[model samples]
Target: MALEAGTVVVDAAVTQAEPSSPQARTERFAWGPVLCLWVLLTGWSLLRVPIPGVNEPHYLGKARHWWNPDWCPGDFFLDSSNPHLVYYATFGSLTQWLAFDQAAFAGRAIGLLIVALGWQRLSQSLTGRRWDGVLALPVFLTLHATGNFSGEWLVGGTESKVPAYGFLFWAIGNLLIGRLLPAGALAGLAVSFHPLVGLWGVIAGAIATAGVLLQRRRRHDLQPTETTYSLVNIAAAVGLGVLLALPGLIPALQTLEGGDPQLEHAATQLQVAERLSHHLDPMRFPKTAYWFAGSLLAIWLLLLRDFPNDSRQRWWRWFVLSAVFIAVVGIAIGFGPRPMAQMPGFGWRSSLLKFYPFRLGDLILPVAVSLAAVQAVMSWTQQPSASVSKKSLLTAGLVACVIGAISIPFPDQNPSRLSPREQEDWIAACHWLRDHTERTAQVYATDVGWAIKWFAERPEYVNYKDVPQDAKSLVEWNQRLWKIARWRIAVMADGQVTPEELADLKQQTGLYALLVGRFGPVKAKPAYANENYRVYVLP
Candidate 1:
């Protein structure tokens, strides 16, 4: 910060003197922070394999599907599927240019860069003196580095949310900078990739825009042209997002009741419909509710402690208010959603934020913690006459360290990837299936995971994790899928499969039931056996 007219003016992260030349503007673009972001995230995902049934295999499979439609699950579900096509299409293009695995890894690395750069922009736009923008790298890396156990961002690998958040950060950053049109466009892009954050962004953009207009009006500087321009910008921004999402949404509408036989009986529709359901059993709220509540409280206090002190700060203040309102609603939805309070198909629209309300905790944590962490760093580095320094800063730092440390359950440095304990067994089973099974052979696993589909190139009977979208077909799909899953579990518990069970299993999986976990020696024919699992080849 520099003294300007007897008031401290923020320098927007760069500490050195101003650059005179136009080229300096481009040269000043900070690459170091982006490098750090890449290194940290790339290092974390290095151990991750891009094979099917690994690290959000369903989503990965979808992305890979676009690259090679002839792959597992094939072009059969192509028309009826309601996956995040925008996200997949982007990465799918990458796969066409690069090796599949490299493309996936590159996507993750680039996604982190987008987020890091967006945070820099956001910090510069918001409390410029607070974070200095540069601090966003460490703050973000630390949050992710705390490991997926403390939290995981939607999936362990490069899932849709990564890029969604990348766009979302930019949207908020633009909003803070009073670039409403771009903000709206980015917000729409975010939603197109990942609907949750993008919807929140719409609220954020509206709040920030309102705050700006109100301030201008109060100063007696409001112009009719300004209002017109603002409205036009808002429409264009939202219009851009809708255009991005049109492909995904349009298909969902067109084929809601029309498709092939498999499509008609498909589980994708059910998963989609379930996602649109807002009312839930309140009993499901307790554990997740507490997590969201705690995070909400943490962010609110951080914001309340420092109200607006400048134009940038004013932008943050309105954002903070919008954020708080969103959090409160999320908490309410998570904790005690009134089943009858909402209209029909609330979750399907933009407002019914109740779909997976608890995950909102994970969504907000990075934003809140990143802002708070960077601001704290700024306090420590600034002049001795800083408002809060030395002891205050030290205490806060220690507290953060303790909170972070306690969150990680293990002694080994927070392994963002899965440990050997979990991954090794999964690897063995998936590899065995890949090498032994025919491409045409379908298998039945307890729960589809990792890259099982990718490596095995065989569809499982019911992939619970691979939730899809639907209208009337959703109920039937869930019922049928769960029935098969339950039957598989029951047969697993029985150890020796009944003649009847064997017959049904044979029909569902063609001839093999690839079951995992402990089971006693079976009297029935066992095709293969390992320490942790067994393959039942139905005769």
Candidate 2:
């Protein structure tokens, strides 16, 4: 019999004879042990990586700027469109009290905690065992670290997508149990943080749900006992999701609209060809990535030799298949016979490619591998026991070794994409700029990377690493980068520029100062000099 609207559909693995209430659901899983394991593992993961990770400054700087516009006033990329407004409003508000580095550490800890808890809940729900999540945690972390076909990762750094993935995991867990409304609400929250991460999850989940319904229908004569959500429930979930996601959805949609065709095309091509080719272009993937992905798949298949017959197996199978199908479609589109522009339906495919279709599979497949391995091991070992077996001791030893190796706190931890000496010199130069220069000062630096605005609190003239998202701004940002490149090649040599060149750059770009790596053959004496860098005051 089909349940009425607003009913919480229980999983087939869960006994249907039990009274279904919110309190019963809350008490379904033991939280104490899961939380303890989550904290230890997640804390270790966060501390393993240093702060200001590759994209940390990229995101946290913008976040700081969002709350306090005066932080990096007039910076081009900082002033660009705000697609992750919800993230800025929530996590970015940390700038009010904490320093940028401190905020990054705090944010990473919280986000990873959410991710860890979500993964545990999902694992436990899918396996119908309390300790499966703990068993799978180390494997999941290791696989996620090494097994990505695209440049996608779950842990590391503070960004909008961290929390988005957390909520996405929760949504997927709820979906496994047919709790559509809660799943939809969680998915919507994920979208509010980062649209693409959550939207791809929703698509994969919808496909899985469809497969479940079709299979159930085909086997109607057998009268399957598993619970499935009705169409009305799906509609309500989608409706609630849309309603909750408007804050982020509206702004993201706006970026794609109201752009000149030529400018938009230029922006799309730049993103696909130059800026994000490593992510969007499948042909460019490294050979090692393929090996890693293939190895994980082989291991999963080997472990799951005979798939367990359980009520939840169908959902797990369908979800994995959906994720793989999405990845294959992405590969097919990206691996065009010719250039994307030369292909049929060029605009449609290029635009779709930008959303990164391979990401879902890159992330999801690792989770599946972890869960499947845990299920297999648990089944072979029988029920949970207080006595630790020899195999259990071995597994624990392996987990400890892996965690210790990755979490080695090296002395020379330079997190700002700079070498130890360069980071120190860069910070000193930025300190000079922050103290000596005005807030309106626009400094130009080619090799400083992304943290000048973060450390110096001054606007940047142009930075190649920081690209604006809006169509017009993207084109302009590109032009500025090329102009800087041309000037550097023509005039600057051996990390040196003459006074005449400095004056010309000042006149051309209205830059207040020039910061360059320390080198000889400079015609003009610098206003400030460090062991690794020099700051030249412009005319």
Candidate 3:
């Protein structure tokens, strides 16, 4: 069950290449790689104007008034203490102190920097190769350039996962090295930032750690008499984890009452993504899911079956364990809950969670393939074995690259609500509202309302958080905002806002102005019309 002599030789070389002493580690700390990745991912965020559609306003609006978070006017995200409270406090304080429209851009740059550093450190730890970090830069960026745009890359600006994953990768590296206390603390902060992704990280991490212990046990190596830090280590790890997680956990538990029912009710009310039909119908196999999951599983099993059972290349086993756990959770989420999405006016049904499992699988596939390819190639270089050859290594690399290339669901453009020009138009419209509207005026805007709330410093008729808000009034407002805004934008009909509907909305919602796009209804009388947009004050 020992590592093949050839693999052992590769490990020896890696050990010689990596630094062991504290001062040496500092010397080897990677800056060039981080700098390269930061520049690549944030070019649009930094050098060019900030791209608007990635929900920048949603988070920035919360930061707009740090001391007070206005969740679409009167409502609030925190009835008491909330996880986002601290996040807003920190980000809001910075945005106010610096005072710029590109706060989200700066925040994203900071997030990418953290990710770059964390990725460098974690990649080296996971693969036991210092150079792998340098290579991973192009690998990760290339995936985005050629990634499933809707699934992997965010729709809007840097969402919570950007920072959350930074901490998550670092935490997992620590967990694998048996440094439980730091791992616990890092994992806690990760959760505080974004519960959904962080929760998955925690679950996957625990399973990876347990998988190691299980492997040891199967080899008859878990005896109490053996020299090992077992129960004591586990206790300390759990204690630190709970202590560090208190900030996120306490507020979450406090707010957990009736949370599920609210979520269920919200799911029923919200519009399901049209693509979700592929997952709901048994006849329509989950092609996206199968493509990624299949690639990941195939490579993982290859390592397990081919590599020596006790090979020092532990990432393979860890990834397999984590992938299995993620798959199970994804399956449960996809199939367990009631349908969260549906085809409007159609009989088909799909859960919001339905495609998530596949999404997770897709995310993991690249990392798995990349890791396996690099390590296998390295193994072949060192091993004088009959089991592997140069041909096998090239084949693996080609396969991984192909999978990554194909997984890119959208290659032509990124996933955003507006193009760069349209984003400028929206920004111009927001500036107009700021200059003209009363401070307390609640305008009627669509998904662009979040931007209005921030830039215009005025309330809008609705928001897009049906998943969180349960109040009958807010829920209705949320639904109406989409229906009204989309209707005005000609979502359903031939780009026309019927006169009767517009009048009824103005009377009911007290909407003072209609912020119309260039393609909006012909009847809109422009109080202010720019090249990109037109705003009509309701008569």
Candidate 4:
């Protein structure tokens, strides 16, 4: 008579005659549609962007370095403290056999496929309809692409988080169907891939579990429609989850320890205020972010208005509300007792904000809206009292077509975030450096972003985009940036660099070569010249 939490209580005789149980529906699940969805998702994510998309270099570059430390030997960021050892250990080996670009393409393909399959199953579990995934996929993509409070993206790019999210989705699907052990295992694997992402999923699952227990308690006095899970079941779920999460969780926690409080405080300030302001500081978000928040509110309102509450779906409600609660807490902290907008000093405020509270909401809110919208439509269509009209159907069809057309993935014109001519020149310069320069040579390229070490296969003095996570390294990285800033200011003052200035720059920074913009005048003759950039040898 007693059932574990999340287990559906089915009447055997009636369900055997109708074959309408959740298990029966799952047994009839078809893979053909899931495969088709996977292909669509692949095209949209992998084929839509060029190899080495935004974070590919950031993550893949580190992956390569982890496998072969000799690679970019003196690069500070690559050699800095690593908190994602599990990700490196899992994916870094690909660099041994394939080129960086090839490995990136392969990783993207694999990650996208996993995400598609997981999403399809998650959709089916929520609605108990196979085709609901097909209908909701485009909606999820639209809402996700529109805008978000934090700069978090689930799809696109080859990174640890992509596969982590895929596993998280699968865990949610399992949790919905009362498979706690499997859910815990999958969620644990998610944590191993990306601790922050996996932890969010774990937290959401915990919230759902609590909701299940409370709902069961509420119904205890009434006719026992469902029985509460034994304490053993709860402990088992938590124990399995912790066992699986330790690999990633331990490293992530270690990163927070053994840091100078003053230095860590400064690092947090730099992260929240300067380096990652767009992601960490809510006040730095653009108008589009606020608009997206309003759209999410509207979606929530519509779901409430259209759908009546169902006890079976209580877990889903609590799961989504957890994300909303996190975002609300983030907004409150962002504009709180002292207000981060005023550039509050280093303290608990900056420390808490640095962990990125809005990230989970960015992904979860859109997912909730997408599923709720489709479910509402299905409910309306099934209503016996509601009469459907041809004109209304036609209007709905038109709207769906418009949404589908907009969701079509197109190749980016500037995939590298550079113009074609500029990109060509940049690659040429990198290739030249790879062949002509020494492997251990230190090169400083102005505004090269994340690709210099990836392409040139050499160490860099410092990169603005690739900051180290540890406090001591971060402080050192900031010093290098200040050093670069001072040199650039002095050299660019006279619209030219004098011999004395070049000598001082070399002595101050110990540079073997300097790559500067083509328009910037230099006192010495360039070693190599391209239309967009010039590589200079430091005296």
Candidate 5:
């Protein structure tokens, strides 16, 4: 009998029999120890300092805005422009109902929950051993740590790449299990969270669909029932995504009144330079010599002759293609532009930029580490063979472990955390603003607008940008207060705002309150200091 592509052609006559009871079948699926281990691993990963990077504060602020029902007047549809508003609103509502810290802890909790769910799905897909899910925990933690360190020097949290990856993984797992519609919906949600992740989902879906179609064609088996199920799944995914996106799409379409000529020119110039840079950088070659070498070795040792015989080989091929695609995108972008070069003390921008298309080469690091662990597990499972010396296999596995150990430690370099004192000081400053300012008062803070907007219960003038024209009057009013008071309550890094600017700001606002950081100097005395932050109330 000809076997199907995915089916394992086992010798059923010699195979062990299934248990005779319904309970036995149910019990087979419950792996308590594995689940426990997975939970423990997840906890360990989350405990690593909350890496505040890549639009994290913005999302938190947006969530806070959503929680305040009285806010966002006149523009109901404009609220949807913030991609994370839905996620934040949902979490914030729950936190508000429970009287929890809606700004800080609640946002982190939701992120953790999403990651955990994603990991669970990934583990189920890869090993069918729920415990193996813990293996991928390090990937999430390491990326967050890296982001935290990087955030110190640049605008880090503008994108939710980590969370996006989690959703993408979940969608892919669902797709593999033949739940097409749910997978598509999950993939759609991932895209809504971060558009780049949606690319991965598309790739995975296309691959799976193509594989299924090819299998059907080769077998000359036209099974209408199975085909119908697959088609339904695909349709469901598309339909669900469209439904969810309708809210955002409609508003976006209405908002496209006209394009700015200056912006159009700048975009065209940037695109030309981006293309040119890709050609000049040898280091930005699509294939990393090191990764290519390792992949070749893996194929030679494990998959060279076994492709047609092993189902696992097909999965491996899919993974390889995905990784390669991600790598190519990263290389292209890494060589593209030095957009963040103007920022002070952040020369490492180029290195971090490489992660844009999921950092194809960096992804190999996790895959390599996981493979080592898998090999170790397989070695432990197999019985001793006189012909195949267990000692050699054990030594090889240890060497792989050492390589992974070395790799993981290096990636953890420059882990950053705000001291408890700093946290307390920042919190106090925010609270002071909350108590002093009117609920509807718009605050024009420099860097910490999002933090203050959410934490201090005031309307932020603008987030991560200078106050727009719509709020120009509010900014001028704040400036007047600073000038009269000889103090300015502005979030500043070491040299971000000059003494002259501070003096001018004081002259402009007539108020004396300035929040300064290591990035800049402050003209006013710090009323409060923390390990990672300082607050100066202008006298």
Candidate 6:
């Protein structure tokens, strides 16, 4: 006999039967533990000292500029370049609110919060349990701990890739809940912050949209209202995101109008695949591949086997596919001919630059960590029998937990942290520039511009190879300057200019002050000397 919705069917002889109550249908949200875990993870990521690579000093400097009321646009050390203004504005506002050191903790805090929230949301969507987010704790620690010594500008800071990752995860969470509009909006916001992150968003969004379509097809009786609402919401969210990003858009437009010469050269230079290969270290290949594969495997196990029938499974499949695409693209670049030339948009051959726009492979680690956690949860929920040995599984989980805990403390040395003495000298130089120099002075220094900007009381000029300048003229000017300078400060490991080259540089372009380290060879008498640095005023 069929049981009716409101009526309960019981055995005829049974004298008593318990009725199901409304309370049984209510869902419980576990907020307390999740919030605690978030707080703990955030604190751990923030308490560490800033590592040297990835332009930490540069970002700190930008934060200082944003925090200062006296500073205006165009005062940054680099020639007129516009960062995603919304992030800067938010950081600036938060610094004011907290009354903290804008360079040190205040700016990083915002990134930390965003990362934590995004991880929490992603975990919720993947595992349908809050505890599963614990797996992502290792990922958060790894990203926060890994310092960028590669001398690339985009690799570093709270404003760099970190926020983009946060936005990506947030979009994924919204997509999991059938919230396409909000997902699109999050993706739009991410693009405004970092245009490259749009690739991840597009991949994730496509998968989500496909999932919705598949679900509708599977359930033929489903109404169109849900689909229509989702589409409309996505459009609205994107529209609102655009409005939010207007400040960045306007400045970018103004910058493009002026036209940077270096940007043009960068576009041309990056076209060679050989240049791109130089940036990637062979040693990192194994680790990168491991993480990528692990994440994919975890996602597959969780969504395909455990949650095969779940509505959100299709989106998970799409996420895995997107990750795979990123990995495959990276491999192709690693092996293919005119490899750099194949990259889209920038130029026919411009993808060889160290910081190629769409090298989505960098995201493999985080995605893997996220999926691992989700898989663990799925496994936990699907345990075959109560008698099955939980001891071994628990031990494995504990081991993973221990490994993650230890990994956070072990700093990788590839980027090489500066010695304490070097750090002091660097800080001293920044302070001197900060106290000295006028606000409007276009102070040019090689190699130290990013750090100098971070420590400067005002903006000063530091030339970056990638800022987009006129290719023909700027390249010639840079070559001439390289001959005179005798020392290269722009890209680390590119090798110092030879003495003969310096003489040629002096003959070509009037060489001015040279900021050399304590150990840097000094041929001529320096105008000023300190324990850590010597300022050689060109004759």
> Which candidate's lDDT is highest?
2
Q: Candidate 3 lDDT, tens digit per residue, 432-521?
A: 887987765667654444356656666666655312322344345556656665555553376566556667667867887777664455
lDDT of 1 at 317: 54
TM-score to native of every candidate shown:
0.72, 0.89, 0.73, 0.88, 0.60, 0.69
Candidate with the larger lDDT of 1 and 3: 3
lDDT of 3: 0.53
Off by over 4 Å in 5: 1-38, 50-56, 69-80, 98-114, 128-130, 135-164, 207-233, 244-258, 264-316, 333-356, 359-376, 384-424, 440-450, 454-512, 517-539
Tens-place lDDT per residue, model 4, 1-539, is 01122222211111121235443364345587688667666666654456777777888889899999988888888988777877777777788789998888788778877787778767777677787777667677766555666878776778888888888887777666556667667777888888888877666555665665566567754233433455566567656766887887787787787657888878887888789988887777888897887688677767966553343355677778877777778777777432453545437877888888888888888878877877777777667865668437734763574365345643342456777788889988888889999988888887665488778888888888889888888889999999989888878888988767878878988878887765367778889988888888777
What TM-score quantifies how close candidate 6 is to the native fold? Answer: 0.69
What value does the lDDT take at residue 220 in candidate 2? Answer: 51
Worst 10 residues of 5 by lDDT: 7-16
User: lDDT score, residue 224, model 6?
Assistant: 34
lDDT of 5 at 4: 16
Computed on alpha carbons, the lDDT of every model, listed in order, comes to 0.52, 0.73, 0.53, 0.72, 0.43, 0.47
Higher-lDDT candidate of 2 and 4 = 2
Cα RMSD to the true fold for all candidates: 7.8, 4.0, 7.7, 4.3, 9.7, 9.4
TM-score: model 3 vs. ground truth:
0.73
- lDDT tens digits, residue span 7-52, model 6: 0100110011112322122123346545654565545544433443
Give the per-residue Cα lDDT of candidate 4 at 329: 86
Error of 1 at 423 (Å): 4.5
Q: Give the Å shift of residue 409 in candidate 3.
A: 8.6
Question: lDDT-based ranking, best first?
Answer: 2, 4, 3, 1, 6, 5
Q: Report the candidate with higher lDDT, 5 versus 6.
A: 6
Give the winner by lDDT: 2 or 3. 2
Alpha carbon RMSD to native, model 4: 4.3
Writing each residue's lDDT as its tens digit, candidate 2 over 73-112 gives 8888888888888888888888788988888888887787
Number of the top TM-score candidate: 2
